[model samples]
Target: MASKQDTAAQGTPVSGGTASQHTTPPKPSADAEDAAKDKKPGTVSIDQDVEDKDHQLPPHPEPLPPQHPSFIHCMPPKNPAITKNKHSVFLAGSIEMGNAVQWQPHMVKRLHHLPITVCNPRRGHWNTSIIPAKDDMDFKTQVEWELKALDDVTVVCFFFDHNTRSPVTMLELGLLAEKHKVVVCCDKRFWKSGNIHIVCGKYGIPYCETFEGLVGLIMKELKKNDLDVDENGKLLSEPSSAD
Candidate 1:
């Protein structure tokens, strides 16, 4: 029987401290269920306590490519006789001497696409007669025409065959060696191979064994000069390199 004033003076457990102090709310019913689920086998979340791995992943690599092929003939352009600003090349080689076939036509066919005027003597007028007669008009005309070409041309190509005695070809070489640019290709079996090689050596001209070699040298020279001549001596729309 404490007096009201005395009771007020003494501090009482304002709330039910002793009973509730150590007590937690009965975990919400679902909380036990959640814990039970977590304890259940294989209950992992993709986004659990695991770390974000995008930044830790090793980088992905790139991929690769393929391969290609090669060439046979240094082929010329499809069309050659089409331009005005073209160079000139004279085919000064064996006619009826060694191979029995004239190479001028073949040379023209190969080089026709180039910006060049090919002066082929084989195309010039001639007869069944072996030698040109000093008095024959057609022979004289042919001779004069060829001689004039030598004077006017930019390059002279000398090809010697082994079968025939091409004395005139030799003379043409000597005459034009100093005056014009000359490319000499002499067959080893030519009667005057030694003499011709000596002359080419003296003049510092390109001397080759095969006709194909001669063409290669000419193309090289053209490339060096940066002339319109293509890699194969054709005037191509898109200048390409030899393969």
Candidate 2:
């Protein structure tokens, strides 16, 4: 028979394994522990659902492949007087508040006095963003609006300065040129002013370099249109001395 001391020296067995050799296996790494917690036996994780909770998405939803926007044609309001006068003018320019304020009010007031009807885009006027037009309103819409405003008006009046060469203005120019309207471009600065000069020259449209000169050109056209009528339409030909 073995003595008790001899048995202790060989180590003790509990059930199937040695008691001293057994451990709680060693606590797993944080990642391993989390992974083990996430996984279930014989089942796969839904990866899409997991990713959705952790990710941010775009504001506008992802569009479908081969998408096409529906195209709609729109026209501007018409006035009977524009047809009878046979001279309609469209005024377009930059919305720079300080300097632009000079010509804009003057031009609008002058058009009100004339027999011709004016189609001035009432955007960014006294207040900005009065109407929130979409960025996608195309040149076709602008031109069609002006054209619809005219009954028989054949002429367009506008000035080109640095402010006038914006994308919208360029689009307006293209539309007017296509219709063979005489363009009157003015330049506020020498360098910025010449773009319209070339465009007008290329398209057989008239151009001026100064606001005063443009005013003269407009008067000349109006006089030519009236033929026998008085040059001043119920207003003094020259600016009032009191003003």
Each model's TM-score, in the order given?
A: 0.57, 0.46
Per-residue lDDT tens digits of candidate 2, residues 1-243?
101110110011111111121111112223333444655554332111111121111111112122112111111322324443445555555433223322433354433444444555422212222233545354345445655643245455665434323555555666676455454645434344456656666766655544433444455555555522343323333221110
Question: What digit string (tens of lDDT, one per residue) describes model 1 on residues 36-58?
Answer: 45443433221112121211111
Q: Best candidate, TM-score-wise?
A: 1
What is the RMSD, in Å, between candidate 1 and the native fold over all Cα?
44.1
The residue pairs in collision within model 1 are 80-112, 80-113, 97-164
Worst 10 residues of 2 by lDDT: 2-11
Instruction: State each candidate's clash count.
Output: 3, 1
Tell me how far the alpha carbon of residue 148 in candidate 1 is from the true structure, in angstroms, after superposition: 1.0
lDDT of all predictions, in order shown?
Answer: 0.48, 0.39
Q: Model 1: which ten-residue window has the lowest total lDDT? A: 2-11
TM-score of 1: 0.57
- What is the Å distance of residue 231 in model 1 from its true position? 4.6
